[model samples]
Target chain A: MDPVFMGQVLVRLLPPLGLTMLVSLTALAIATPLGLALGALRAELSDKHPASRIIDAWVFFVRGTPILIQIFAIYFLLPKLGLQPPLFVMGVGALVLNSAGYQIEIGRAAVQSVPRGQWEAAAALGFDRHATLREFILPQAARRMVGPVMNELSQLIKASSVLSVITLFELHKAAEAISSANLRFSEVIVVEGFLYFVFIFGISLIASALERRLSAAGALAGAGSFAR
Target chain B: MTLLAARGLVKRFGSFTALDGVDLDLNRGERLVICGPSGSGKSTLIRCINRLEEPDAGTVVVEGIPTTDRQALRRKVGMVFQQFNLFPNLTARENIAVAPRKLLGLSRAEADARAEALLARVQLAGHADKLPSGLSGGQQQRVAIARALAMEPVLMLFDEPTSALDPEMIREVLDVMVELGQGGMSMIVVTHEMGFARRAADRIAFMDQGRIVAMAPPQQFFDAPPHPRLVRFLDNILGH
Candidate 1:
């Protein structure tokens, strides 16, 4: 493969890649809050309660199956219900559905990591379980779950590549167009892969750096305070 | 008039009976120390006073409010823990200010000023913005005490305030507590520190199983120890 051809292909691929990242980041913003709320609802709420089982069943259905299939269902099924959500919405919907499944697991683990006594203590202090989870547990849980969430976000960046199959013209789509035009499929794939690598790698660096800073800020002021 | 009252406080955790049938009373400005074996339910009994652990069967009334309304009970009573359950994400100041800001509807500046004063009282003025993670265990516990003080609570609960601290750090934390006691804070302290109990507590209550076996003025409880178990338990803790 010619280096010049590869560079040119990458140039075409960058915009789509950039857009994909934008979409993924936006999707990530929504996924974190929604996923965590759903996750909290599961643990703090009981299966015996009417809503708990329903939430469990939803999580089960989402997690039990594959993302690609869910995307196809959302893309195909919703229009039948007379709602033609935009392509961006579909892409976001796909990303949200897929990421939420993973996030549900992440969120559940984070909520559980909080000691039972914390809630008990809060309850004793006069905060109801609901208020306690909101004010105390969730904030601490969010701090603990940051690394996993970054990992999920990195995965989301990669998973978004799947969207190209639906013809949304994300970074991968640009690569495909360049490939089809140049008749240099191998070079184009390499270019796109590198782009994905850069995007994911850059995000990973930022996330870890932010994590360090947050931990530092959170550490107790003096003497044997453990950083998060 | 009783500030807090628990009647036939029976608490069970699954098959294990943590508290069998404990009953107690507390009054305004009274400092009470609860001491017993690890499973003796002293912690549970005090915890129940604020409805921390709801008794399977029994009624707990705090400041004329049924313990069933935990939120209302909590407004009247504040608890500091051995674990120093300060909010990790929040700064030392934020931890102190949370209940006041949320429960009392104090503005941020008001809460901060109040928190600042409480932190100063605990001798942690310089570390106000620091998170619980950066503070020493003793320091964190002090912050917890400061947090409770932020509520200006009618009654306070200290569940082994010094137990989780280092030996050298114990006195530092206890010093602050002793000061609170002197200031006439109504307190229920669950601790093994007999010396502290003797110095600060107006009354001493000793528990075994789930019941208080002895309750009297510290001088009487320590000197006479009518219950055989308290005599042994006190001997064991002091020995340890």
Candidate 2:
């Protein structure tokens, strides 16, 4: 492997890093809010007087299928139905749906960690469901969700590698393109792996820091009791 | 006018009756102390005052408002939880300011000023900017009291406010309650601290098995203790 060609492979992988993160983050923006709403709604639905099964089907359909296949069905098969979304949109569309599916579990777990007494307290304070959830329930849930959501974001960063398979010019695709042309595929793959590590590691650090800050807010009282 | 009235109060959870046909009344500026054995519904009684627990059968009327109107009732009443229940993501000042600002439409400056004064009253003036994590157990409970008081509530409810604190931290919180009692705030406290009850409670209610077995002036109730269960409970606790 010539160091100079290795340099070219490194340069080729650069553009894709930015592209991959941009695409993954854009997918994340679309996925998170929808996932949060669905997760909160599902929890309320489950606790309803006579429980509904529609949410069950929604969760089942999403968690049961493969995201890669979901993307393939949307990209390769949807064109036959006269729904001709471009490759990038299909890629992001698939990622957002997949992201929302996993994110829903994370969000629901966070919402559950919020003490039920809080909802009662807020309601007792005259806040209706909409105001109580908005002011108290969701803010607490958002703090709790920070850790798992960050985990999801890191997962998205790694999963963006898959976008290369659909002819998207992501980091991994650039590595593949340069390697196949130069026949120095091993070196390019090594470089690509390093980029993935850097991206994921940076995000992991940010996630932990934010978790520390948010959980510290009311920490003293719970801790203070034990400390005394 | 009665500050609080519980009429035929009964609470049940899946056949386990926590409170059954209990009735009680509280007057303005009165301090009531309640004590009982484990699962005796002392906690449930105060909890119902502010709508923390729903009575399976009964009515709780606080300051002319029905506890059934939970939202409106809560704004007029304040609760200090055994666990503190302060928002962990907010500073002491912010925790105190939240409901007043949101519920009462107080400006941030007005709420902050009120919270600061309340914190001072609880001897926690220096701790306003700190998080609950940075405060000691006594300090956190003090902040909880300040948070409750910031609402300018017509009545306050304390559910074992110092139970979660260490022994050394108990006196600090008890002293604050005593001061609040002297200042004419109506309050109901659920506690095992007989000393606090004697010093602060105008009336004492002893509960056993989902009923208020006795209610009287503090001295008479603590001295004579009209029922056998009260006698046994006091003997076991005070004897030790």
Candidate 3:
């Protein structure tokens, strides 16, 4: 467990860090709009609407199941159905599904948090449904969703570590490889834990800063006089 | 000629009727005040005018257009709320400019210019950059009025616009509203501000039990209230 040897091993793990970043970022990119749409359907639409009911069931199914099992299902089950996506795609897909479930709740709560008066005022001022959501509703809801969505983003990054179980050489897998080769289990574990902490902590800082910015903009509050 | 009319506007909340066969007419440049005790359909009638609360039954026509024609009706009818429903995320200028920019397709510059002028009209020239949270209740309501005026609506609906303000702040909002009335904006105002009704309203419509119990010129309505319920309400509100 020489310090210099540990540094080399950590550096070797950097490639997997890149893989983690790619998978998580891509998952977030795909999940964001999909989540917003699902969230809007849940919040703004009636329970009787088909999409609303579908979202309700989708959310329950995704949230109720464990993320690890979801990844396994996507990795192992899809191939049986003749959809043999690459392991990377399956991993990202699972992350996207899991992240979108959480994001849908965040987006729904944020969107619903906007006062109903905003919609009424927009309508009274001649804005249609899409215009109201685009111009007035989303901007405000986005401000409120910043902290929560960022929290979810950080979670996705950590969750990507689970992708190694599916043969993806993400951070944990790369570290495990190094530890097994060198027999310095404690040092590799500690170093990998530190890396995860750094990544999640960086995300946490960005989220708080964004939260501050949104609060300072008073963007959400400007929509109405509702006290947070 | 009527610029806005509601014929047989009806609304219900479960078992409670909020509005029943409500009929009202607004001519261009007319200021009409609505007054009633809480839950008397005063707010409901004005809300139906803009389709904010869809009437359970009946037709609302604005300048020969039905409420079913939502965009047409909305563009022509602007509304202010009791709680000053200013877009809380926007500054006074943006709140006033958003509709015109988005709906009227005004260029950003043009909309901002219009917002500036309307803010001046509401005597809020110094507060254009302030968000609703930064402003007082009175200032926010004035900004709300300015936001409505920015639409250049053919008719304005004020639903208890001053009811949420403090006694001291009520005058400032009322003053802006009075100025709008003098400027010849057609208005349907729901308020218990009898003085405002006295000074600005050409007609006063009193509601009770989800119906207009009396409708007359302000002076006639004040001097000789037709309904005993209205007389009692006026006495209770104005006696102080």
Candidate 4:
């Protein structure tokens, strides 16, 4: 209700926004390739393969449990086992592990969604398995993956708020601290909410724009006559 | 003179037999048309030659090299599918160009030039930049032919290439194929288009229940089909 007070809270939220960005972006950078690799392996290997089973179990565990428990385990449990990482590392690592789980499914669905004919076409053209995947399969699959990947990214950015529990000075922590000090819970919380909305909404916009561009370029290459 | 030989090919999917004790041969520059009732293994036989479906028991030798030499088979054999199977993301030209550039190691410019020439051959030069979705069924099939031709294989296998086309679109694709046959590209086409079989085939093989019921020159095969099953099949297909 108080515009001036809200303005003050917004300025305070800005500095920690960088840390929030760093944690999420860093997690994404690490998780994207890792998830892609794991997802690709899971998709490529039969369910009977040992590595596939391990990856399936890993994904199952990460997805089934609360992410907060995952963070607590990494932060509190890992150190108890005589291995201590920095607080920031623990927080980012938890986000990386959590996001990568979702990303694995994203990557697998993208790869599997590519038509079987594409693989056969590549093979009939004499492409080895590796070249077939790299040149034909992945290029087509990647277009389909954009929307899911961006959605995962948005979820990751929001999930970074949980890092505040580990005492990392990200945006949510800043909001909490300012609210406690100023005794202005409504004003601070509302500004914090607005900032998160803008950030996540911006990502969604970028995701849609990217989806449009890629689909225009490829135009649902996996969906048309070839799928038959 | 024999470019390909498959002896005693037996392919089974679970308990159902797709190809059973099939034997086939292709002399250099020969055009062979295979027609059969659905599920009679017409598609499966050609697919085996290309190693798309590994035979449960048999051998496929192309140009004296066995199918185990996958690279040689890849280089020496090209296949067109029933679905056209053009890479949807790539333009018509790129679809034709990719195999040559990647497998044959042609530089981009060289590959593009080859694609352009092939597009012209298939009578699709003007539509090079268009995606498969933008093209008609006939145009896409032509592009598919061009894509297979880009490999410059001595042998081409077409697995019902026009089966999925609209009736009007079938002729344009068949024309391109007939032109390829005239150019002496050894081919094994699995199609129900008896018109194409008559015009382009040197030998027509009739199959039923995964075995070739009859094999003869097109004139004799049509006029005097050797097997009772083939007689019933031809009557069923052409009786209307």
Best by TM-score: 4
Docking outcome class, model 2: acceptable
Q: Tens-digit lDDT track for model 1 on A1-228?
A: 799877777677777887898889989999988887787777777769887777677678787887778778888999999999888889998999888877877888899999976786566556777878877787677677889999999889888888877788899877877778868789888878888898899999999997886667553221122111
lDDT of 4 by residue, A1-228 (tens): 799989988987998987888888899899988998789778899999999888898799898999888888898898889988887788889998898998889889889998899999999988888878888787787887788889899889989998888889899999999989988899888998889888889878988987887787573453332222
Q: By TM-score, how accurate is candidate 3?
A: 0.94
lDDT of 1 by residue, B9-77 (tens): 789999989889877888888999888889989778777777777788888777767655768878778
B52, model 4: CA deviation in Å?
Answer: 0.4
The deviation in Å at residue B119 for candidate 1 is 2.9
To one decimal place, how large is model 2's interface RMSD in Å?
Answer: 6.3
User: Candidate 2: lDDT of B156?
Assistant: 85
Name the lDDT value of residue B150 in candidate 3. Answer: 88
True contacts kept of each: 0.51, 0.44, 0.80, 0.67
Listed per candidate, the RMSD to the true structure in angstroms reads 4.0, 4.4, 3.2, 3.2
Q: Which segments of model 1 are wrong by more than 4 Å?
A: A75-88, A173-183, A219-228, B66-68, B238-240
Better of 3 and 4 by TM-score: 4
Residue B102 lDDT in model 1? 75
Better-scoring candidate (TM-score), 2 or 4: 4
Each model's DockQ? 0.39, 0.36, 0.53, 0.51
Using all chains and alpha carbons, the TM-scores for the candidates as numbered come to: 0.87, 0.88, 0.94, 0.95
Give the Å error, residue B187, model 2.
Answer: 1.7
lDDT of 2 at B3: 82
Instruction: Give the TM-score (vs. native) of candidate 2.
Output: 0.88
Candidate of highest lDDT: 4
The alpha-carbon deviation from the true structure for residue B217 of candidate 1, after best TM-score superposition, in angstroms, is 2.9
i-RMS for every candidate (Å) is 5.5, 6.3, 4.0, 4.5
